[model samples]
Target: MSSIIKELVSDPHSSEIISLAVGMPDPFLYPLDVFQRILENMPATNPSDFGYIATEGYLPLRRTIAHMLSSNGIETTPERTLILSGAQLLVLPTEAGLNLEILEDYLIRYRPKLFYTVSTYNNPTGQVLTEQERRELLLLARRHRLVIVEDDPYSQLYYEEKPPLPIKSMDSFEGVVYIGTFSKTLIPGLRVGFLTGHSALIHRLALEKQYVDLHSNNFSQWLINFYLEQGYFEDHLNFIRSEYKKRRDSLVKAIRRYLENNVHFNVPGGGFYLWCKLKGTITSGRLLQEATKCGVFFVPGQAFNARPTEENEFRLCFASQPEPVLVEGVKRLAKALEILQKSKTPRKISESFLKPIV
Candidate 1:
């Protein structure tokens, strides 16, 4: 996880590299005006502002987040929402996002209490589950009496078509637990995330979190609340989507022109990644080594798989860099592919190849 993000600013090759490894918001696009306004309006030397609030979080922020989620189709209230300094762990490891049948099979085999997924613009794959798939998944969860955890941080960052309503929205049995974050749409430095679902579940989580830390930073929550109130959140979202769409298109065109038929890929409707598969015999480990040498880096698909590694597959993100940088990154990746294909022996796999990107 850290490996992918580390490449963003801390990579040794930052000056020369055109890295498309991390799926992060472009810092240049942050709404500094909104921040300034929020700061300017802050109550100077106020005592209550810095005081610790409930583990459940500040009421206004939770209510606002609940309203936003409701408008997007996920129904919830502040009471059911739990604010967290970090996201709740959903530890079901799978090769890919859960399919209805796969989920049911796992439930039967493992008698697992919950199913977890990133349904829209999925992390490394950039794959969005279809409406029908979402419906069936919910149905299966109901039938199995299982909990479904929907980790949806990227649904709002769409490129072309709006993604299907989250499985949480479609859940009729109240079996879905929805988790979201401001890290992707907003800046990552603002570490705020929330969970919504059964009030009992939230209460239990809140109780556990109380021991971890009294609560998240009240100032950060208030800052985001002010950003939302100013009506800049929506505007900022629209602006980033347009900019990201351009970068997405650039990546698609660059891959077509450079990698040619050496790889197979799907253009995502929304999200930061371009999931790709190698057409040749070279493994993703070899490709990464070669690509790194060419001043580019990518997360191999094997890192996301729960079973054996799919060394022929890899993910390239187009969100962090601008269009020109994305184009250059793709070109470097192509050069790496050429070198990998031409090499007769496999290169030594690096330990970093096993690190998951999202």
Candidate 2:
């Protein structure tokens, strides 16, 4: 992902390169005009809020987050939450959803210090664990006294019906830590996020945070809080859902129109990706190279897996482009697949791409 971003950034030919690899909100959709109005109307000097505040976060913002979480069925308090920049997540393997049998064995064998999950509208895969699975995961953590970290950044971006409440909502044993951010819904530049967990855990995390960056940006927090309080989130969220769903449908239609016989994928109800697999001998690695040459890009499944894999799976994000561009990208991908299928000596990735970012 870093190399792809670097290539796009450094290369003079980047304008022609279509990237479907990164999970990002489109700049075209950012509410810059609304934000300008909000900023223009703000007070120039509010010393208390502008200066260094509590390590936890702005009180009104934390209170707002708590209220929002409660509306979604997750009981929280400002005392149980902490302001954060973002989170560090490690991806694990899955099909349409998590398999508890394999998860149980892995937990017993590895005895990991912490287990992390995206749970809803998962990145790269667009998989959402069912409510029963969420409950079972909580049960597993309770049984083993394991710490389950739930980082749900895409739950609110669903395209259709809402996904099940996060595992943290059903966490009866205080074993789950839930993370939320506005990067997807609002804007990434705000750099505002929060973590909800047991008060004791949040206290320790807050102390550790004081040494790192002290606290999250107070101005950004205030901006988001004001935005939320003014009832603009739901309006912006509704627009995002409508626009992204159109692009998602366009990408799906294009793929089906061009690669139906050679590839297969699940059309996610919500989220930004279509997890795909080629049916023939064309490997994801070879397709990736050919696709790059064809001026289209995507993330191979190897990057998301925990172990070395030879699967032909790949991820394509539709949110970063418009309907026409998304269709054109699929056409380019189809051409790349055609090139790979015709090549006698198909190349493969010599090194792994599963290395962590951030």
Candidate 3:
């Protein structure tokens, strides 16, 4: 089994418990009214509006997304964009069989050909690559003539500072395929995401999509278009950023106070997760099992790595739970650690032997 799956299975009640293993955003934070308005505004009055759209996606939605990308310094046109179900779907299939050797600098010598990366606020780990790392990876891709697929769903949700420019912005040769999703910022049920790359590549992907699902739902595309045009998405994103930031802060402070000094992790600037490394003899797998017994659960760190390593780490979500719940959860996690520490103590036996009773 994969290391992550193994760690999860090690949980005492792996079958039944609260889960922090997944990377989804908080449901309560979804922009329901904005999507509702968009749905209500769909031009069902015209039969053509409900029909199949071009496999590339709705023209206007693509245009708006292109505009959003350009505004962020990617310098791309709508013709270069292809809408997809979600960022992962867009990345997984296209990235298969690609050569990572092309970008040797960006990868560890043994890095997998396909990288399921989360450039900013990576799923589970929440470690955003530094600007220097981003440039090195881009340059590596260019030198090797390899494709670098950047999955950036959490860039906009940062709490402490502005997010770095997406790796797409550095693509002078159109070597990077950028996948973005609105599920985290907007409502996930919309299942709206887009892929941006060279026009030729996008055209081929659209063709593949045509044979598969024909096209995305026209009504949903139209609804998203209307929502973008109305300028409600920006305001909604700001509101989400503000509220999620507060929750993140609460979790960070609690972890610092309740967790042992040996547990180390970097505080994320914009994303929803906190990645932690436990110290000494305890492994993340063991901690997860103990945490479950105390009513706290989190994903083991091995899930993010494409291969196994010696590290004992895991990820915790600060955005999903309310502040009070987050605080309580950390306290319970601390209690679990105490139990594990005590279990490791060596018991002292009497030097003198006593006679046995009949």
Candidate 4:
């Protein structure tokens, strides 16, 4: 999928080809000037700024994260938040660590074990776990002495209504670990993200990070802090939200008007993807091949699932393409589907019957 996206990007005529393929905010929406200004203002501080800082991340960035989370109702101390490269790294190891911590906590509490998660809009799906579902899962986790790892990267890109609070906010038992990233909301190349959890678990993870990168990019952290402190980050996020929502609307409208009923998908509230399930006589692989012929591409859903199945599905990212391009891409996809449907033939199978021994 990455190679396909790369090929699309490398093609001189790629702009004419609509790409619902790659995940990332449109370049037009980036806060380039803000970032540039921050970079331009960087002072030649101690050699350590160019060198390694703390493994957990620079103190200012960690404090900023704590303040940001606190404003959203998550009371995270700097000690309980460890900066990482991005949310993916923050989530994977933290999830593994949470599993161990939960087991140990459960053994001490003499309780059963449980783990609840949103694994759909999960990465490529773009679906957020609903509020009621989140509450119910938290209740179950609490009852069973389990931990909830709410890996929310796309929650802030909603099309309608405000985003829900992090599940960590509802953790009376301190069983929720929330991971967030600037890669999606801010700039991808910055590689800045953080996680919130109990101090003990975070401290252990910080030690683990010490062996990894020693710390996240101090210059990047300083740049982010500078941007946020200057009050440009929120404005930047607002711009991104507006642009992404517009693009998402365009993709949905185009799909509804041009595509047939053979394709079905959920319109996510926020995030970068549309999880499409093909119906009747079409496979994702064939659809992809046809789309490629038309110079369009998307990721097949099997890559996101732990256990691959015969399900015919693919993910479409709208945030990476403009409205006109997305519409054109969807049109290409609709045309491909029509072609595939026309080429399919029905097969009849007869069951052999043995007459009763007469």
Reference-based lDDT, each prediction: 0.81, 0.81, 0.73, 0.73
Give the poorly placed runs of model 4, Cα more than 4 Å off: 5-17, 43-47, 90-116, 119-121, 345-358
Per-candidate TM vs. native?
0.89, 0.88, 0.82, 0.84
Is 1 or 3 the stronger prediction by lDDT? 1
Instruction: Point out the higher-scoring one by TM-score: 1 or 3.
Output: 1
lDDT at position 285, candidate 3? 68
Note the residue pairs that clash in candidate 3. Answer: 158-270, 159-270
| Model 1 misplaced stretches (Cα beyond 4 Å) | 1-13, 43-46, 86-112
Q: Each candidate's root-mean-square deviation in Å?
A: 5.5, 6.5, 9.7, 8.4
Model 3, residue 33: C-alpha shift (Å): 2.3
Q: Across residues 238-305, which tens digit of lDDT does each residue of candidate 3 receive?
A: 98888888888888888889985858888788877888889867877677778768877776666555
Candidate 1 global CA lDDT score: 0.81
Task: By TM-score, rank the candidates, best first.
Answer: 1, 2, 4, 3
| Predicted structure 1, TM vs. truth | 0.89
- Scored against the true structure, residue 309 in model 4 reaches a CA lDDT of 70
Candidate 2 per-residue lDDT over residues 1-358, each given as its tens digit: 4566566433323568897876767778989988899999985546789899999999989999999999888899999989887554323345579978756754674444687888998887889999999988888888888888888888998889989988988987788889988877778778888999888778866876787788889999988888888889899999999999999999999999988898888889887788899899888877887888898877888878788676788888788788898898999999988877777895656563433221
For model 3, the stretches where C-alpha displacement exceeds 4 angstroms are: 1-18, 40-45, 90-116, 345-358
